[model samples]
Structure formats: structure tokens, C-alpha cells
Target: MVVLVQKLLGHFVRSEAYCLVNGKDLPRLDINSPAIWKASVEVGADTEAAMSNWEPAEKRAFRLGARNFYLKATGYLLARLPFQNMTLRSLRCLSPNAREEESSGSELRCLDMKLPQVIQPGDISMLMDEYTVFQLDTLESAENIDECWRAAFDLKKCDGTTKYPILSKLVKAVLIIPHGNADVERGFSENRRLLQDRARLTLESFNGIRHVVCYGERFDSDPSSFTVTPEVLKVVRNSKKRYSERLALQKEQSAKRPREEPEAVPNSEGQDLQKEVETAKKMLTNAELLIAHGLKTNDLAEVESGNSLLASGKSRLEMAIQKMAGSKNSLPANDLSVHF
Candidate 1:
């Protein structure tokens, strides 16, 4: 029972990318190895030979099971491990490409889209060239990913600056990725504590407190141990000034924006009808004035225009009154009608 458990566990432990890259004590497992079937080398001649002793049906079942396990485990690891995908494994570990004929084609295209800033389109060729040299340099020296990146960063040009600036940045970004969510969980806990007692905190205030907490935690410093240097005093003094400036800038930006006219409130049917009545009254008064002017000057055109205006005003007034009456008729009988 112990031997069976160890054999299974050995494969799982060896499957880890970190263990492989770091050259951990556990030897890499081969599916064909007889040791996989039995704990000790003395137990079997080979996997196939040992399987020959079993029933034909058992042999077929074991092969099928192994095939399925390999496929499923490979897929699961590809998602979590960087540079361990079938195409990408060649980049970091110098693993032979599955398709060596197509090796000349862009391998960067298959890169996980997690680092857009680090891997720009124009720098693709340069990045590949740097990675080529990086592989050769770390062929034996690199014990782990951290050392590999440190070596990459150590590569200097004529001016003593990093040879592969972009690649170095990419490596740094990748290495900084946390293996677990412990830090994230802790951050959520801290945020929860800050928000207790129905506390009302502004975004700026929350961020400031978060920054202070992070700074103290990172340096392992107590609040009392913090030094109040001249720079700190200056920053403190100018804080209000900076705040005022920010407010002024915000106001200026708001003033520059095009003002949108307020939406006109929709009038109810009753209100619309009332407005129409008022408009008709105004039109009638204008028509009467025109008629009076025509009578005084004896102009036929003016008199004709006044008559047309008067007809239009009368029609509008009648329509509005009819609509108002219709609306009233649509309403249900009130309780007062029961008394009647």
C-alpha cells in the first residue's frame, strides 16, 4: 500500500514546473518507466513485460486510463504554469518543440496575453533574440526562475545598462505574480476592518490609509518609529495647497464642458389643452387688432388676412374645448354622485 501511494505521489510531485525548473531532488517520471508500475526496480523487468503477466483486458484498460490522465493533467497544468504550454515550453526550459519544422514561425504569437505592456508588437524580434541568448546562458547556471531573471537583468551592454530591458521587465512582472491568494485574502481582511462601524470614508481617504498600512507592513516599522524629516514636513505643509489646486483644475474642466439644456417637462393632456386655449385667445386678439386697422385704413388685404386669422383662432379654441370635455367625460363618476 505504501509503495503504491509513493509511486503515484512521485509522478505528481515531478509534474510541477517549479520542481522541474529548480532541479529538485525528485527525478522526472517517465510514463514508460517500470518504476511507475512498481516501487522498486527489482520488482519488474519493464512496464510492458510486467503488464504481459496481467489479463489482456486489464492491459487495454490500463493503457486507456493512462492516456486519459495524461491529456487531462497536461490541459490543467497549461492553464496554471507559465511557459509550460506545449508550444511555449520551448521558450523557458529549452524543451524540444513538438513541431521543430515550424520552429522558425513566431512562437511569441502563442504567448499568454497576460503581459501586453511588456511584450509590444514592435519588440517581438528583439525579445526573441534576447530569449535565445538567455536560454544558452542559463543552460546550466539557473537553479530557479528568480536566479534566471537575475542573470537576465545582470546582462549589461557597453554603457553597463541591462542588455534586455524589455525581456527583463517581462521576467520581473511574471516572477512577481503570487503563487497563492494569501496576500489578496489578507488585503480584503484589512479593508473589512477599516470599514467596520458603518464608517463613511472617501476614496482618497481610503487610499491614503491603505498606503500607510502597506508602507508600515512592508518595512516592518511602527508608527512611533517613523521619522518626520524636512521632506515629510514639506509634503505635509503643501498637501492643502495641492488639494486646492486639484479642486481649481476640476472646476476649470467643468466650466470648459458644453452645458446641456435641461429637458422640457412633458405637459399632461389637461395642461396642453389649457395652453392651446390661451394661445387661441392671443391669436383672436391679434386678429381683432388687424381687423380694426383694416377698417381704419380701408385696406381689403388687411381685412381678408384678419378674417382668415379669426377663423383659425376659432377652430383652435373649439378643438381645445372639445378635448377638455372629452377628458372630463372619460373620468369615472365621483363618490359625491352617490349622494345625488
Candidate 2:
């Protein structure tokens, strides 16, 4: 049991790019894509002969565990396979004309991209030669690869025309691919669940429910900072009471699956960034709603309140930026990506 667990876990711990999404840095094609391809290549290298008297049952269990993870990671990567292929083709060296190569890893052979007339093959080559060398040089000076990659895209030349437009586009496309959708996918999944029971939910109802959930979370995280509204308290307390009663009843009545162990939580810096980002979003939405309502009713007070919200949102954003600047070694996840 222990050996099987180690073998299965070893693959995942190394290939965290399968699930950890880092929006700030550039994507390494060697690491991010074709996880199963690498694993399959490796599986044969580790034979049953290495382990004395390895039984068929043990082999079956190991294979099952590995395959389960392999299928999920590969499926996720393959779904975005075209994007991954094009990114590789774009970034690789010029001599081999990846389009012409038989071994070009494109699962979908045709990129079928409507190429922008401005960005030609020559442009890609020139950028690759210059930018790749510059990125490499940055490696010598900077402490790590990540710091160097960020420095590579620190665009300074902002004349009338955007500087290195084509390169910037490529960087955004390739570099910004998430290590994993671990953080972002949950909200939408919950949204679907929230709406499942109600077929006729209006836009207002949808937004309101979402806000309640969001506000509820914020309130839980820092009770001192969050305004404790009576309505929110009543709803939370009542909901908790109901849920506790139901959960206990369900456990008594039927078969209960063991609770999955919780995943590792991000550090404090990350949590703060996430909170500020959410606060900023909430404030912006409040501002929008106020302004819209004020316009509809021609109410001066409501408009004034909205302007205040806009200011508050800006302040939250600035604070988040300050936190980032303060903690370079342990900077937070990209929260601004959610909004703009």
C-alpha cells in the first residue's frame, strides 16, 4: 500500500504544473504540456523485476492509481492542446519550420489561425532571437527564473505605438496559462449548484445570491473588518442551524463517504491579495449598482454613495498593489485577472 501511494504521489508532486496555476510567469512547454506522455515514457523504465516477488495484484493497483491521475491531467491538457501546440511552434527555434516538420507535436495538425498580417514568420524569428537571448541574460543577473521572466516582459518603451506588440501578445498567450485551475473553477461550479433548484431565477436573484455568498465569506474571514449587518447575521445563523441538523440526519440515515482531506491552503500573502481583490470587485459592483439605480430614480444621495464606492474600490486596489510590492519573495496570486 505504501509503495503504491509513493509511486502515484511522486508523479503528481513533480508535475504540479498539472494543477498549480501561476498567472505571473511564462509557461515552460517541457513542464506544462504532455504530462501523460512523459509518465508513459517513464513507466516502462520502472519494471516489476526491480521489486522482488512483485505480484499481479500490486501491479494492477499501481497501474490503476497512475492511470486515474494520468487520464485527468492528459484530458485537461489535450482539451487545450491546440493552444499548447501553437505556443510551442511559436516559441521554438526558426530553422525547423515547425509547420513543415513531421514530428511537430500538434495533436491538431492545423493551427488554422487567422494570422495577423503584421506578425509574420520573420517577426517571430527576430523576436525569438532577441527576446530569448535577453531572457537568458536576465537569468545570470536575477536570483531565479521567475524573477527573470517577469523582467523580460517589463515593457518600458511606450511611444505612440505599443512596444514589442507581437512579442507581448505571445508572452500573454503562453506565459499566462495557469499551472492549474484549482482556485478559479470552484465559484462557477457553486453557481451552477446554487441555480439547480431554481429554474426561474432572475438576473437580480442570481447576482444577489452570489453577493450573499461572497459577503458571507468575507465576514467569516475577518469579522472586525466586515460590517455585521443584521440581515446577514440572521441568514448565516439560520443557514448554519439548518445545515447542521440536515448533515447529522443524513449521516444517521444512509451510507456516508469519508470526507476528502482538504487541499493545501495558499500562504497569508495570497489570502490578503485574494481578499483585497474580492473587496475591490464587490465595491466596484456596488458603485455600478448605485450609479445605475441613482440614474433611474434621479436620486443625488444614491449617486454620491456610488462615487464613494468607486473611491473605496480604488483604495482597496492600491493596498493590494502595496502588499505585492512589500512581499516580492512571496507575492500573492493574480487577483486583478478576475476583474479586468
Candidate 3:
């Protein structure tokens, strides 16, 4: 009974027809109603033939029972189901095969009405054009939801610019909406197992473990069933080199930290400080690339190493900034000393 009502509500929310739930058409699950039951079930040739044998009192009882059931079902749904706002109903426009008549300019215009910050009024025309092109050109053979959006995104205009930029943005925003709270639930489960008494792990290390577990699960459930490809072997081999580089970078940066804050520096030292800053920037860029690669490959260890390297580079950069600040502060003093 609950499931049936939920399905009906889902249909109502997704329905393109405005004012569907209003007036006499509101959903009511009165399965016990004698007329409805007779219509739904296998019966004699005619409606009169089907219920002719029932006593008048029995018929009245059945009608009363159906009324009570309808009230109960309505109450249950009212308590459980979320109130459907117009914006949620507007999502039908995002559907791959949503017709032009169904998703007209007026309907699309209403999307930004509730949330002006997200969907601007000016974006409506471009979004409409993109959606039309998506329907006509891209949606014909698209096998899946993602594919339908991807094809629309790849469509090009006459001048070679992207054909559906606004549509693509809309699709991306919709795609990121979590289908359920499964991931959040799983995170809590993972935390419970990892955070047992005395099993202390740094935040970075804990995250690395979670990533590895997630990566493993994506392949196969059993650890032994995991297949290590050549690419995996390559990453493993370079892991030591990456770790060494991180350590060296950290050591170098630490060594360069001003022990006793230098108040002044000569022109040569100022030039050297600028050079160090440039070098730190380059190192930071490399570290960022390393982190990107790790994320692309789902390698948490590599990501952690990259993070360490990035921190080291940031420290080096700060040191260079300090030197520059001190140089500027003592410039007048240096000039006066040179004159004496």
C-alpha cells in the first residue's frame, strides 16, 4: 500500500501536466471500494451480474470499509511524502526526451523564478535553444542518460563554439544531485571500523585507507581477486621515488627557514630571494600536477606524498616572502648606512 502510494506520488511529481494534483484528480488509494474492486478483479460479463448477489447491508459495509481505507492511506502519505514544490516539478524539463510543447519557454521561464540566483532570466533563451538542439540532434540514439547529455554538450554551433553550454551546465548540476544517502551511510560505517579504540590514524592516512578500500571495492569484493595491471606496477615502482622527492623537498624548505629573523639583506640577497620564490612556485605547480595524477588514478598514497610536497613548497614560498618583506623594511637604513 505504501509503495503504491509512493509510486503514484512519484508520477505526480514528474508529470509535465500542470495542476495535476488539484481539483477532483488528487490521488486516493481506495482499493477496497466495491466498484473499484469489481472493475479491477476478474468478474462476470456485466457489473450488475458481478455484484447482484450481495445483500444491501453487505454493500453498505463494503462502501464504509473503502472510505476508512482511503482516509488511512491519505493520512499515511501526507505524513511521509515530502511536499512537492513547483521547482521539483520543473525538473521534467531536464529529461532527455522532454518535448518542446511539454517544456515550453513559459515552463522554462518558471525554473529561475524560485531560485533567481541559480537560473538567471537571461539564461532562459540560450537554455531553450540548447534544449531544442539536444532533442532534435543529439537524443535520437543516445543509449543512456549521461550519453544523451554528453552528445548535446559535444554539439557545435556554426562558428565552432559550444552549442549547449547552458544546457551542459544544467545537466552537470542535475547529475551531481545525490540519488540517495548511501555514500554518507557508508562513510559512517567506514568510520566505525577505523576509529576503534587505540587505532590512531592521521586524517591524511585515514583518507588514504578509505580511498584504497573504495578503489578495491570498485574492482572486486575479494582482495585476492584484485588484478594488478602494468600501470599499477609502474605506479608502485615510482612510489619510492615520489616519497624520496617529498622528503627532499620538505628538508630543503625547512633548511631555508629563517632561524633568527633577518632584518635586512643586500641587493644580491634580495635577488636570490626572488629566485627562490620563483623556484618555489615551480615546485608548487609540479606538486599540484602530482596530486591531480593521483586523484585521476585513485592513488591515495601518491596524493598524500603530493600534499606533503605542496606543503613544503608553500613553506619555501612563505620564507621567500618574509625575506622580501624584511628587505623592503630595511631599505632606508641600507641607504643611510651606504651614505655614511
Measured against the true structure, the TM-scores of the candidates, in listed sequence, are: 0.36, 0.25, 0.37
Q: What is the lDDT of residue 175 in candidate 1?
A: 56
- lDDT string for model 3 (181-283, tens) is 6854555555446433212233344454555566678677687877767755555446545656767988999899878776665557656766566666665
lDDT of 2 by residue, 1-340 (tens): 2223234334533545433432212133233334423443234454645634777787767766665665566435434444434434444322223223434322112221223333465665655454444333422355453454465456455565544455556445544443456634554355546644243333344445655677867767576678768887666666666666766888876556666777778666767676666667776676677668766754433455456555666677777777866765444355565452
Q: Note the residue pairs that clash in candidate 3.
A: none
Question: How far off is residue 137 in model 1, in Å?
Answer: 4.6
Candidate that beats the other on lDDT, 1 or 2, i.e. the better one = 1
Global lDDT of model 3: 0.56
Q: Write the candidate numbers in order of decreasing TM-score.
A: 3, 1, 2
lDDT of each: 0.52, 0.50, 0.56
Q: Model 1 clash tally? A: 0
> Ten residues in a row with the worst lDDT in model 1?
331-340
Candidate 1 residue-wise lDDT, 41-74, digit = tens: 2222477787878997887777667655653554
